[model samples]
Target: MDIREYRESDWNQVWTIIEKVFRAGETYAFSPEISELEARNVWIEMPKKTYVAIADDDEILGTYYIKPNQPDLGSHVCNCGYIVSESARGKGVASRLCKHSQQVAVELGFRAMQYNLVVSTNEGAIRLWIKLGFEVVGILPNAYKSKSAGYVDALVMYKELKT
Candidate 1:
């Protein structure tokens, strides 16, 4: 697996991954009915940097975006979101993207990284993140009206990067 900055030409495969993941109503907070343009804006427009994980043949396996947790006074801390292709789950793609994102964030001068809205019911992701050294700093009660879990809380995780 390899990780790299996103390019315009990557959107075709990127969108396919996004569509598959978000439509499943499992991990991300995005609405299942989210349109392609809206999805583009959310995944591309909002982040300071976006990255894709690809296989040896260049098949996109997962993606993530990093941006300031808050602009102006809070730019030192960054926020990130990730999505893995359905077929690529459980294969460490998301973990690789996450580890890479932290490295890139440090190289970009970010002091810390945070995940703002991780669904509490997503045990696999929560476990992976914790194993990756992110701490659950807070929980937003009933933040995600999950399709299966229903009104689940969102875990706010934070990790301080080495300067």
Candidate 2:
């Protein structure tokens, strides 16, 4: 598999991956009823950069986007969101995308990375982020309205990319 910059052609496949995750309402903060145009704006247009992980056969396995965590003075700290196709989970697609995102972050002159709303019930993602050197810097109680778990806690994860 390979990770590369997202192209306009990747939108349909990228949306398919994110749509299911958004509709699940279990991890990301996006509304379950988020529209395609809105998703495109958030996932593609708004971010500083977007990427896709492609299989050897050229299938889009996963995607991620990196952008400033906040405006102006906080722009040195970047934020990212990731999604792996159901068929690609457990195959390290998310992990690879994350690692790639960090490299790209540094290349883009970001000093750190942060994830503002990681649903606490998502153990796999938490574990992977920790393994990749992010820490749970803060927790918001009952912040995520999970489809299966009701209002669950959300975590704020952060990592200093530069010393």
Candidate 3:
């Protein structure tokens, strides 16, 4: 998959993936009832930049957003969220997006990257993030009310992008 900065026309495809993930209450904490306008503002307008992982034919396989972890004094650290289309999960789409995000983050002048609410029960993601060099910096007990797993902890994963 090729990862690149998002385009205006990519919104529908990006929303399709995000809406399904959010509504499932599996990973993201966004309300299932979030409106299109709200989603546009959050996933598109709010971040420093957004990206899409596309296939050879240009079908969007996954998406991610990067932004400052905090405002003002804390803005040197960046944050990101990723979502891969279900059909594209095992194909390394997330891996590509994540690696690409770091490069973009550094290019954008961010010194580190953080993921504030990674659901603990999601072993695959946790493993991948660890493999990608993110450490479990903190854990919020019973943080995410996963639909299937009930109340699960959320992990704060972080990685330094530069020495």
Candidate 4:
């Protein structure tokens, strides 16, 4: 598999991956009913950069986007969101996308990375992020409206990329 910058041609595949995850409403904060146009804006246009993980056969296995965590003074801290095709889960697609995102973050001059709304029930992602050097900086009680778990807690994770 290989990782590379996202291209317009990747949108359909990328959206398919994200749409299912978003519709699940278990991990990300996006609305389950989020429209394609809205998703396109959020996943592609708004982020500083977006990337995809492609398989040997050129299938898009996963995708991620990196952008400023906040505006102005807080811009040095970047934020990212990732999604792996359900079929690719447990194959390290998400992990690879995250690792690649960090390298891209530093190359983009970001000093740190933050994930503002990681649902606590997403153990796999939490474990991977911790393994990759991020820490739980804070927790928001009943912040995520999970489809299966009702209102669940959300975690704020952070990592310093450059001293």
TM-scores for all candidates?
Answer: 0.96, 0.98, 0.97, 0.98
Model 2 clash pairs are: none
lDDT, candidate 4, equals 0.94
What lDDT would candidate 2 get against the real structure? 0.95
User: What would the TM-score be for candidate 4 when compared with the true structure?
Assistant: 0.98
Candidate 2 minimal-lDDT segment of 10 residues:
154-163
lDDT of 1 by residue, 98-142 (tens): 999999999989999988999988999999999999999999999
What lDDT, from 0 to 1, does candidate 1 have?
0.92
- How do the residues 72-129 of candidate 3 rate in per-residue lDDT, one tens digit apiece? 9999999998999988998888888999999999999999999999999889999999
Question: Which residue runs of candidate 3 sit more than 4 Å off their true CA positions?
Answer: none
Quote model 2's TM-score: 0.98
Cα deviation of 58, candidate 1, in Å: 1.1
lDDT of model 3 at residue 102? 94
Which of 1 and 2 is ahead in lDDT? 2
TM-score winner, 1 or 4: 4
How displaced is residue 34 in candidate 4, in Å?
0.7
lDDT tens readout by residue for model 2, 42-154: 99999999999999898999999999999999999999999999998998888899999999999999999999999999999999999999999999999999999999999
- What does each candidate score in C-alpha RMSD? 1.0, 0.8, 0.9, 0.8
TM-score of 3: 0.97
Enumerate clash totals for all models, in the order shown: 0, 0, 0, 0
